[model samples]
Structures are given as structure tokens and as C-alpha cells.
Target: MAKLTDEEMMKMMESADNAVTGEGPATMAESNDGIAPLTVRKLMIIGCGDGGCNIATAIARKIPDETFVIAYNTSKRNVNEIVCDMKVYVTSDADEKIVDGSGKSRAYSKDAFKLNAYKNLLETVNIGLEKMPDISYIIVCTTTDGGTGSGSSPMVAKLLSDNIDVPVLLMGVYPSMDEDAIAQYNALEWQSEVERIGVPYFVLDNNQHGMEKPKVHAAVNNQGAMIASLLAGREFGNSSISIIDNRNLYMLLVQMGGRLVAAIDDARPSSGQTLDDYVMAMLQKNYQPEPSNVKGIGVFIKGSRELLDKMDTSIPEVQKKYGNAVLRFAHIENSDSVEIAVLLTGCSEAAPRLLEMKNRYDDIVHAQKEAASVIGDVMSGMKNLLGDPRSSKRRGEAKEPDISALDL
Candidate 1:
């Protein structure tokens, strides 16, 4: 699981396949370091019902080449409900400008946004299968709420999991309690259901990351931007070395912990140093790498320290394991606890390689067993509450399988 260097990855990307050394390229022919020669394929991007129309519009604008289909429930008043409000602007590289398209490649918010979100998702999948037939991937970017995101997302995940064997990654968002408790609750419910389906989910919550400023509207806008960035190939900070998108490393931070501390020009000796050098320098300046007995790299922090001090605590352990690791830290306004983010870019081959746990066949098996046990317990609880006869009747009436019986 040795992390691939940017040079190595760049070479791959420039070679036969535009791959950067990693498991990120869309096509199998291209190594992670390389990008496969552009192919015209379908990539269905789904957004939840209601305000999610805005997210769908944003996504439609970001990646223009692919055939984008957004499925949502349009029953309720949403940001998109207003006439001309959810206008999706297509970003044109011709003049480096964004302009409205002639509906051909613009945002599409259909009325079916509300008919049983999950059922609608199934219908959308069926439509895509019939229309596109040859799809690269189905990227589900939804904030689990209402019908489209909450209900349809799991169904879509299940469809991909059961029928289409593709690299289906879900970029899900969770709203804060203040935003709407109902939405928050629905998000949690959808999350649990999707987890039961066992797709590779990259989840981010509005509550986890703070905005640039304290203003409410500004924060919401920033959150939207962050989600857009993540969907547009930005990595998540909480991810392991198994998931970092190295290309994005040049410009963006995966999460709040992996902030952009410095972008040096390498004035002194650019020729001699390597990409690893730049990454290491960032870690060294911020923190000292400390080895730990537990094998796992530990980033320790004390109260009342600057960003560098917080980063210092984690670097020693990470560097010892991974040569190119970036560390960052932040202090609470009034608390003693310091938050730390350690980004490992260069894990040695000897370091036990972390496999893609979510999609592994073994993981699925384990998840299924776990889910079964949990469902058994839940059914037993239900039996206790409603009596065995009612519980048995309810079980028979259930349409979906006991998802808890499938959790890993």
C-alpha cells in the first residue's frame, strides 16, 4: 500500500492511460496515476428532493461532458420549485465563463421528484439502463432527506449493488439540527438504510465543518461550495491513505484538518527535491513525527497551542510510517481540546495495506451476518412490544429485507 508519488502518478497519467498512481481512474485500463483516454459515457448524478435541486444544479454545471441525469421528487416547494430559480448554468471553458445552456445541457428538475423517492430512484435507474446502457458510474450525491435522497438513494445503491457491478460512490450530506430536525432525522434514517445496503459512502455533515465566517448565509454558501468541491474529485480528510485523491492535494484540503498551510515555490533547489519533499516539509514545519508502540500513528496535542504545535504532535508517528504525511491542527475558541488532522501520502509497502473495506466481498459477508444478528434483536424487541402475533404479521408485511441482518 505504498503511496504513489506525484511524479510517478503524473508519468502514468501522461502515458498510455492518463492515470495518477492510485485507485481513482474511471477506467480500468488507466492506472490510478493515469487518466484513460476520454470516452463518451454516462454518469448519472442524483440529488435528493427539495433543496437538493440546488445541489443537482451545481453538479450539472461542474461536469458538463457527461450525460447527467438528476432524479428528485418535485412535490414540495424547494429552491427549485420557483420558476427559473433552479436554472443550472453550464461552465464553458471556451471563454472561461458560465452561461445558460439551451436546456440541452442545463439543469433538469422533473415533477417526479416526489413519487416515493426510493421508487422514483429505481425508475430513474431503469430509465438510465434503457437509455444510456453503457454507463461508467452512478455517482449518488444526495443529502439524505425527503424522497429522492433518503428514500431513493438506498434503492439506487441496492440496484447498483445487486445488478450493476460498477464503482458506485455515494457522496452524502447530513444537515444540522438547526437546519431542520426532520431533515436531520431523515438523513440519519437514510444513512442507516444505505449503510445496510453497503455502498462505498463518503459522508460529510454540515455540523462537522465550520464556515469561513460566522454569518449564517455565508456558512451555507461555503458548505455548498465544499460539497461541490468534494463531488468534483476533492478527497475527504477523514479518509485513510486508501482514499486520498493526490491530484487535489496541489490545491485543496480534503477536510478541515488538512488545511493549506503553505504553498512553497521551492526557490532553492527544485530540481533535486521530489514531490515527497514538499509534502514532508509541510509536515515537518507543522509537527514532529513521533513513533508509537501501538503501530498506528498517533497525533497527540495539548491545550492552548498554535496550528503548528497541534500538527507537531502527530507528525512523528506518521512520518515514521509514511514518508510523505501532512499534519494540521486547530484550537477551539475556549476549550482545551485541540483537533488534529494527519494526512498520509506515502505509506511504505511494508505498512499493512488498508483494503477497500466497504465493497470487499469479505466485508459484505461479514456485514450480512452482523445485519442478521441486529435484525434478530430488533424483531425480538418488536415481539416484546407488540406481542409475537403482531410481530410475526409485521415481519410478513415488510417489503424490504431486514437490512440490519446485512450490516458488516
Candidate 2:
């Protein structure tokens, strides 16, 4: 046996897709009729800015064929090579020259959206909605540290909230500790604005999972894709207990209305592995704070028949940890490993890093103000105090450190 190459794997997947669609006769278990053939619920994603668009592309690959992932970006260079269901350019016709990027300035992206990109963006979104009217959920993803994502995502989310009846979620990618002050400041500011918009949102911190840039990027995108796959529900298998539909996703992410922390764990079939263990694992893996005023929580566990039969559906361990919160649990069939996903909302106020950023921003402002007040005329004040450079007093004698002992 030999391992398949990327191209080989892709061709196999394409052939399987063709088989499912009647390009050839369908023989797969999933292709068989009768069992409702997986969760039919669909979820749409709109990714804004560089980071968001990249994640969207990754998500598009992971989701089912009918589901669409749309990317919105200002730079042609940013999204040209990216592969997604649709790409909408955020443009400004008024500008004499075409700007390829937001230049790390959120204001630029926001102004462009408000000025010229508004109509096009809204129209394109409506068109997508019309094409996929069955979409139950809409997730708007963006990189909070970048100019375009930080500036444009809030307005985009708000626009969707105002016009569409569907539940919309904003997924903002947070900057890592190693990122520069500008990126940190942009991320911090964007977080504040998104929260104020009153849209239920989640921030995917870039600092965790990996240290290197590419690793961190992949980790965040992969985590987001997993959330999408779980929320949309699988396209095959019957539930041993209750099936988690898009409505559950809505109850936790949208109706809850605050920051979200979602995690998924693989529970291999074993005597020791319990549903409680799976939920606890997810809790441990969550990037956000532990659920404190959790308005709502949705837990979905999928596994084979044997696994589901053996599993204890009770979530006492979770309730004991999170206090009183709306907890919804569902266990469906997956045919593969026992998979579990938990979504917790209403932890926005407990983010410590955002508080640290606010303090840091205030300190910077205060220091600048203090420095400005004192330095009415810096060089002139120094000259007046020292008299003239020609005077002996103006030139102070150097006092060197006695390093003769250290030199030895």
C-alpha cells in the first residue's frame, strides 16, 4: 500500500462527489437512501479582510459542497490566489488610484466600506442569500489586527444584522503577543467596537496552539473549520439520541449574545472514555475564559452506535463547573471516532487581555500628555539653564566608571 499524494487525494474526492451527484452510480454508505443521510442543516460564512478571507477559504474546503464560503477583501493581491466559493472585492470608485490594501490602518477600511463599498457589499450579500435561502446561520470572520478586517468586519456584521433575519456571528482573529504595537492596538480596538455592536462574537486568539506564524494561522483556521463542520451538522448518519441542528447553534451563539468559546474533542471508542470526559476535554481546550455568566451552552457528541449506547448522556461535570447556565446536549451518529463539541457564550466581560490592553492604551495616552505639557521649549530651556556653551560651566566633566578591576 502507498500513501496518496495531494493531487491523488483530490481526484478521489472529486470522483466521490461525482458519484454522489449521479456522475456515476453511488455505492457509498452515505450515498444510500432512508436514514435522512446526515444533518441537512446548512450554514453560510462571509469572511472579511485578509485573515478572515484566508480562514474562509480553508472553511470552504472543509464544508459540504452545497454550502458556500464567501470572501470579502480590498486587496486583489490578498485574495487572488485564494480558493473559496465566492470572492467579493471591497472597492472605492471615488479614489483616483486603487489602493491594494488597508495599509494597516482600520480607518481606511472603515471609510472605504462606508463611502463606496456599502452598496456593492450589501447587494452581493443579498445575492448570496438569495442563492442559498436555506442557510440557517451566517458567520462573518475577520482578522482583528489588520486594517481591513478590523475596520470593515463590524460594519459588515451590523449590516447583516439589520437586513437579514438569519443568526449572524462575528469571528475576529486576535493578534499574538509577538505582534507589534500597531497590530495589538488594532486588535484591541476592534474587539471593543465589535462587542459594542451587540452582535454575538468570538475572538480566535493567534497566540495559542503554536509559536510560529504559519502554525498559528493553520491552528486558528482549522479550529474555526471544525466549529463550522460541527454546527452545520454532518450530511450522513442517524442519531442515537437527539441530533444537534442549526437551531442549537443559534441558541448558543446568537441568542446568547456575547463572546463565544467553542471546542471539539475526539473520543475514541474505549471503556474509559465517557461523554463527561469529552466535555471536560473540550472545556480544557477552550481558548477563551471558562464560562462565567454563561447565558447558553450547547454540547453535541457524535459517535458510533456502540459508543453512543455505552455513553452516559448526563453533563453533571459541566454543570458543576459552570454554575447555572442554559445547557443543551445532543448525541448523534458519526461512524468514525466519538466526537464532541461544546459551545459556551457570555464570557466577553471576563477577557483579561482586553483589560490589559485598555490599561496600556490609557498609560500611553497619559504619558504623552504629561511629556507634551512639560516640553514647552526643550532645547531653549536647556540653553537658558546652562548659560553659553563657551562658558566653562556649560561643559560638564565626564565621570567614567572604575572598571580597572573588571578589566583584570
Q: Please report the candidate that would top TM-score against the real structure.
A: 2
lDDT of each: 0.39, 0.68
Task: Assess the local accuracy of residue 215 in candidate 2 as a C-alpha lDDT between 0 and 100.
Answer: 83
lDDT of 2 by residue, 36-133 (tens): 33455677788888889877877788885646777788888865656666777765576534458887899989888887676777787788888888
Best by lDDT: 2
Model 1 lowest lDDT segment of ten: 345-354
Residue pairs of candidate 2 with colliding backbone atoms: 38-235, 38-236
lDDT of 1: 0.39
Question: Cα lDDT for residue 49, model 1?
Answer: 46
